[model samples]
Target chain A: MSLELRGLSRRFDNAQALRDIALQVDGGEFVALLGPSGSGKTTLLRILAGLDFPDQGEVRIDGQDMAQVPARHRRIGFVFQHYALFRHMTVFENVAFGLRVRPRASRPPEAEIAARVRRLLERMQIAELERRLPEQISGGQRQRVALARALAIEPRLLLLDEPFGALDAEVRKGLRHWLRALHVELGLTSLFVTHDQDEAMELADRVAVMQAGRIVQFDTPARILDQPANGFVAGFIGQAQRFAGRLTSQELIFEGLPLAPLPRALLLGEAAAGAGQGPAEAFVRTHEWQATPGPGNAVLRSARAAGGRVQAVFAVGPALIEAEIPPGLLEPGETCQLDPLTARVFLADTPFATG
Target chain B: MTPRPAIAEPRWARIVLCVLALVLLGLFLVLPLAAVFTEALRRGWGPVWQALSDPDAIAAIELTLLVAAIAVPVNTIGGVAGAWCIAKFDFPGRALLLALIELPFSVSPVISGLVWVLLFGAHGWFGPWLQAHDLQIVFALPGLVLATLFVTFPFVARTLIPLMQEQGRSAEEAAATLGASGWQTFFRVTLPEIRWALLSGVLLCNARAMGEFGAVSVVSGHVRGETNTMPLHIEILYNEYQFVGAFAVAALLALLALVTLAAKALLERGGPRGSLAA
Candidate 1:
């Protein structure tokens, strides 16, 4: 189902959880609500699932107002971060709960429920664990059971709140494919909430990057990586180091380092008409710079080969800048000049540059 | 993670503490319980059977069972409902309400019994109206049940609150989001989770209801056959110097307590011990 939120606002005594939040999800799209903790992404997901109500604003599912709908009737499946599976129930029983709870007239027969639960467990790759309780299974298996349980009701929209947050990394990577495949096979519109940017970037079709109860950017991961919406997004998205600089509409220059001036066009998304360059900051990732042999003030502190690339750190004056450059560029402690020509410096024009 | 050496302590001190604990328990608990059983059987089974089969003893037993039957379930319902309200929701005066639920625990049993008297006694607050209306509460079965209820009021709710709070309502919310109605969520997901704690609480509440004395004494008015519970019956027999009768009834009460404790222990075995410890 297509989902839309308009001007949603939720306030607690001391904090505004969500403020005038507006979001739209096209049918069958996998959208990630990416933000730091306390950013209201989870609150927004709860409101969408009818587990929580907004103080002000409308939640519409397929253009129908959900104001009068209760959570049980919404048919919007929600997977908790901790995988709130019934600890006492076996995997089979947990998955069948949604179907068995239906009204007598609508409830499936016992044989049908069993078959359906088995099929869902198999699809979750946990069919053999049907007889085991949740506590007996691994974290990843528990999450699969939780997902299978949520899906048993045939919900059109699935909401996962850090579904893999409780699992370790190796298991998390394996399960992401299962969720994406299920989303595609079921053609369900899924909204996933996570603070892990890599998880969001790897899984989401489009990510809604939020800060302080507002969506700062809503775009594909590639666009968000290349063109951050604001200073916050620029700092939040990539693991980029910050260097205070001045942009003069022609080129960018750093304060302490005597590096070559960067042309204006290299600072991607910073060329808004008349974007003044006084007291600005630039975000540069490790791979954005190149090292060419030269006798310069910058010293090549160390270089290491990693993942088929040369990962090295340079001591440029008092600051340490990491760069992923061409292999055999420079030996350790060698003087080399930085070539930020192919580098895409994410520039934040604002003075409050957190990056 | 490997085993470590125990903290070194003087062997004499450890032996002293262990002996002290055993001696204290033998003097205070094991000795008295054994005395009750031994004294009851000292006159042999013949007199003990006669004392147990006495009309007054039989009536007291019936009354005690009836009171527990009425009070246990009433308190169970109230306790579970109160616990659900306190643990599952936040509202104004929640702390105050919680404190009030535990009020009986803090207040003396006599005071709690006196409270009912003040509310329903013929010479108490509503006593005159109740007497004029020919409605008997104090010095009757209702009064006895009310006193027992007052003393055991906190058992189930106190047992449930900490556990419910810790387990949380996430599982219930998950069930609701999966299309289970509120009642369905409770019965299928929530009830099964808390069943062990509930059973443990019931055992304790039942044990207290059967053995309550101070509160029941304040309101029972010592009506020999009608109002006296098991403990009160034993008290009256002891006062009349009927050692055999009193000891027989005391042995029965002790057995009941032991049975309840065993049940509670079994329940603890089946679930987290900390849940029942609350």
Candidate 2:
């Protein structure tokens, strides 16, 4: 089933937890809600699961309005960071509980329930722990049981709130792959929330990058990493270092240092044309810079240095100037010539240092 | 050869500290109990059992345990529901409701008893209406139960509030998303998570109820064979100069308290054993 949320908002007494959030997931698609803590990614997931009701907006599942539906009636499966297994119940009983408690129309017979639970336990690779209470199992195994229980109901959608967050680094890596395979096997629409960039990139079909209660960019992982919507998205999604600069005609200047050629589209208006080059910023990949000697073509700036090695620095103008050099080629006081290969530029209205 | 070492504290300091500790312990806890037990045992063990086996005293013991059994569970449910409501829900007067629940803990047991008596006595507000319905409360079994319930109500609720507050709403919401109905979520997920804490609260409530003499005595009217509890029975023996019998009843109550304390320790040591998933 497809799921959609529009203009979802919630506010606590002290702070706004979520605001004007809108998103949709196609059937059988796996989406990751990626954001830092307090960014409202979990809040958004809870709203979709019907565990939380948004102060505004509506949730629709496969064309059915879910705003009025209770969480159980919505047929959504939510897996928590903490596995949340029923500690007092055996693994088998915990898995079977969801089905056993269903209304008569949806309830399976005792034999069928037992069979399903057994099959699921086997599928989850925890069959040996069927009779063992949750307290007897390890954290990772408990998470698997929680998943098996949630899947036992055959839900229309699945929501995972940092499912592997509680596990150690090694266990988290293993569960991510296992979850990907499970999603394929079940063919259900799923949304997993996490702040780990690598996990989101590896696990989701689409990565929705969120910051401060808003989705800054939502696209395939590769596209988001390669071409972010803005400097925030770029810095957030991947390892592109930023710098401060100003735009000139076909060039960006940083701290009185002229950078390499800028994209024609970026060089617009008075600021781009250098009328009020004013303040600007730029971002460049570390690999995008080249080392050279002397003021060569495309060289942005050259500074004085000691020893035989000179320190040359190039600016992408909208960003900062960076240099590439051989190991021990230039000491702290040495200088080298540099040039930038590509520049993603941003405008800053006031003069300031780049960090 | 070098000297081996000097102790952390001088020998005289150590001896003085130990004696001080012993003296404090004796004055606060050991002395009174020893005095009571020695005086009672001197009268011979025969009279102690005779007083304990007295039909009225026996009845009082039975009634006290019965009341505790009923009240503990009722308050357990009440405590959990109350804790959940205060922790997880927001509405007007919530703070006030919380304050009111804690009133029992701060209010003198005698005052608590007086409040119940004022409400259930013949000249009290609900007395005539209750009498009209042929329901007895004042100086009756229900009055004794009411007084005991009032004094012990805070035990479970107060114990549970902090625990419930510490355990957040994420787990319950997670259970709900897993297709568990509200009741199933509570029984399977929420209840199990809080089981040990709830049990401790219940035990504490039971212990307090057993020792709840002031409130119960005021409303029970100390009827010889009807409303008197174990504590009241002990009081009756002491008043009749049957010190040995009083100590016997007190010893039995102490044993119950010890059992409750031991169970509490075991449950606590278990330490949320099966509660974690990852």
Candidate 3:
């Protein structure tokens, strides 16, 4: 199903849970909603699944307005964060519930229902757990049972709310790969809500980064990383070192010291054109900053070999910057010159902050 | 290394507390139960059998069971609906609604019966219209059922609310998104999660309904073989100085209470898995 949302807004008492949210997902596409806690990503997913209704909005699934459709009639499959498997039921019975609850006129026979549940169990690799109660299985196995149960209904669209949020790191990595493969094999239109940026970037074809209640940026992982639209996206999506500087026609001045020349493309924007000389901020990824051995203003405070790279901290006056460098390239307490291989410059209202 | 001390408290204090508890149990619970059985059988098995077979006693037992049969199921349904409404949805005056449901629990049973009488008695609020419609509520089965319902109203709902609230709405939402209707979700997901609590509540309600004395006595006109429940019958027999007969019927009610306690203990021990078969 192709899903679209327009002007979605929801309020809980005095708090605005969602505000003027808009999004679109093409058929058979795997999209992910990524954000921190309380960012309204889960609320948006609930509205899409018809579990919640927006105060003012229109949700269209394949050209059909879902405003009047109840959740049962919407034919959307939802997997909960905690699995939510029925504790009293065996795995097979839990998966068969969707088919058995259908109206009698359209419901399949018992034999056919059993066959379909068995097939889904086999596909989810939980066939051996059919007779075991949910409490008798591991968390990962319970998750698979939940997925099989949701798939039994043959829904038009699938929604998952933090599907791997409760699992251990090792189990979560495996499930991410399995879920991506399943989405490809089934060719289902799936949208999953997650707070882990790595999981979203690894599994989704397109990622919608949400903050507060609105989608700040929606694009591929590479685009969102390489060309972030705002400061929030640039800081949130990856590690970046920010520095306050003054931009002029010749060079960018940091603390009255000329660091580098201003890029010509940055000077073409409306803000740059309106104020040719003003305070500006520059964001450079940790790996993009180089610490070359030389007599310079900056001193390398520390260097440690980690994750196949040397992570070194440098002190340049009051600001401390982190950079990833090749191992054994720089010693502790050595003076070096810092060079920015690539950076994004923006107009800042305040001084400077690094994270 | 030497072994650590095994006791948390001094040995004398533990012994004293244990003996004190045993003495209290014997004085309060065990003694009374033994007295009832002993007194009932003191006059020999013949009188015990005769008291049980008396037409009035038989009628009282039948009436008590009938009232339980009617009141228990009505309260169970109402309780489940009340819990579902209170726990699953948010609305204005929700706290007030819960307070109202718990109101009957805090009121005296006699006051509960009196309230019904004030509303449905001949000289009360709905009396004239009910009389015009040719209905008899007070001193009748309907009045008895109403009073019992009031006294036991909070059991099932009170048992279920905290449990249902803790379980939350995620499971129901999952069921709905999987194409199950509202009714299907309730029966398959919501009810199973609360089945054990519901059963425990119903058992308590049934036990109280069968043995209720204050409410039933006020509503039942003491009409022989007609309005008399088991407890009322026991009172009459005792007042008439038939000690053995009174103790015989009291023994039966005691057995019912014991059975209820046993059932509750079993259900609590098995916990959520107890109602899996249902």
Candidate 4:
């Protein structure tokens, strides 16, 4: 019941849309492909759905090769971002379309088809919209109809391409939760592509971060957030103020300050991190450092008014330096003193923080 | 609330411009129609009725209407298939095929008829083969129909191609993902979206087919009873010094064109609503 891609690649004339890549999803696993635009995430999903073929790769579902299988034969349900519900069809007809078009192998009797479609409509909570055309319904309702239409075929695998991208923020949030619950209830193997990090984080069992047609990190949401494989993943995962700095044996040296002194264990970890790591970088979660003024606190070297009367105050730390000030409290070109020791250190070349 | 003042403009100048435009329209577009009506009234209703009752004239008008009705749907089907091929499929010589489809529109109608004649005339290519098989074309009804078909083919296909291309491939692909078979996707999703454009294309094709004269005339050989179309009937009457009868026939065709136009509008309104309601 596992899906695997081996050496998948696709090229369009001068541009390589998908470089040689490989990935796997275990049975009933929900994996989200997260990437910026043109990173080839959607292309990979298309290949998996059999909508497009990779120039060089073998796609296997449950150990069965898909070389001879056309997209119609693959039995994979796909949900589109725009819903793509048949604008001319009522909700009931749309949900029934898949079943009605089924081949002899999986075709159900008319009564059974109707019952199945009704069940799916009930499941998606769109029975009331059964008679409504796609144009007559709201976007969210159309999306649900699209989902029901896809699910009615009883597909072995489900693929969703930015299913919530077109919706507003509030609808997106609710739909994400509903999709997660439905996935759990159905126990269906699913892969969805999304550019929104929050969507990937909140919905996927495993988030696969993509960049330049390659996966930078594939792990649980918390793991990827806490230990991003590279700077790109780190920056993509969460908000962290970073300062470029050099590493010392005992401390992170940045702006002439001994930032949070590294312990022996973390220093050893940093030393053994990678090759040519002299010009490494450090990052500090702004919420981690408390803002205070005292002689014991590090002196704020520079400050400027961020906006209106609010000020941004900068101070040096042991391993990293950051700015913090109350709104309209610190004026421009002012200095303040703050404490250090709450910063995390990482080798500049790589994105992994010193544990 | 206060009353607003009108914008400044010389009232006489506006009136004069409107009159000038009306005069231009009369000279260019209305005068000929007025002359046709006046000429028809010269012989009273007797010549008009006689022309309408003539077997040759009746056959010509019927054939024209029949050819238009048949050719329009054939072209509509061809248009949808051709549009889909150009929009969705990529194959070698696709551009050339598209160019060929549009060739009828740009090439001279006389040349188009001559080309068909060269292929099917008694002394032409395939002529002996068609004769041996007892198939009639070139100077026959079939030849007239074929010539009309050739010149009208591009009307529907051209109208539909750009619309289909602009829609992109997403909706159909999306339907495929939802487990719709090719036919279902076409009828339920693709056809519904393009129905309006399809109707418009059909109207254009029908209008062109009905009005076709140059290509049809060359191939029809003007066989008064068998091959003469409505336009040909009108021309024959005028050439025979039957001016009143010619104008009467012309008026009849004009009335048919008006009916077709009204039908087109009604179809456009009804077809789209039906598709949406489906």
RMSD of each candidate relative to the true structure: 2.8, 6.0, 3.7, 5.1
> Can you tell me which runs of candidate 1 are displaced by over 4 Å?
A255-261, A271-277, A331-334, A342-355, B1-16, B270-277
Candidate 4, residues B1-278, lDDT tens digits: the string is 97555874687988998999999999987898778778887878987899788898889889898888777787888888998899888888899989989999899999988988899998889999999999889988778878888999987778778877877787788777767688978987788788877877787788788888899888988988788989988999999998877888898887777677788778767764543221
Preferred candidate (DockQ higher): 2 or 4? 2
Specify the poorest-scoring 10-residue window by lDDT in model 3 chain A.
Answer: A266-275
- Model 2 earns a TM-score of 0.82
Error of 4 at A257 (Å): 12
Number of the top TM-score candidate: 1
Writing each residue's lDDT as its tens digit, candidate 1 over B1-278 gives: 97555896787998999999999999999999999999999989999999999999999999999999999999999999899999988899899989999999999999989998999987699889888889999999889988999899999999999989998889988998988887888788878888898998999999999999999999999988888889999999999999999999999999999999998887788784444536
Q: Is the docking of candidate 3 incorrect, acceptable, medium or high quality?
A: medium
C-alpha lDDT (0 to 100) for residue A189 of candidate 1: 87
The runs of at least 3 residues in candidate 2 whose Cα sits more than 4 Å from the true structure, single-residue gaps closed, are A131-137, A255-280, A293-333, A346-355, B1-27, B34-38, B53-59, B90-96, B122-136, B255-278
CAPRI category for model 2: medium
Candidate 3 per-residue lDDT, tens place, A1-355, comes to 7888888998888778888887888999999999899989998888888888889988989888895577888989999999888888899999999898899999999999999999999999989999999999999999999999988998899999999999999999999999999999998999999988889999999999988888888899988887666666677778887777776765555645435555645432233444356677667788987777988867899888899998889887677889998998888889988877666655666322211
Clashing residue pairs found in predicted model 3: none
TM-score of each: 0.94, 0.82, 0.92, 0.84
Residue-level lDDT tens digits of model 1 in A1-355: 7888888899988999998888888998999999999999999998888888889988888899894477999998899999889988999999999999899999999999999999999888889998998878988888989899999999979999998898888988988987888889989889999999999999999999988888878899999998776767877888777777777868878778877877776666554335665666677888788777888767888888998898889998888988897888789888987766533343453432221
Query: What docking tier does model 4 reach?
Result: medium
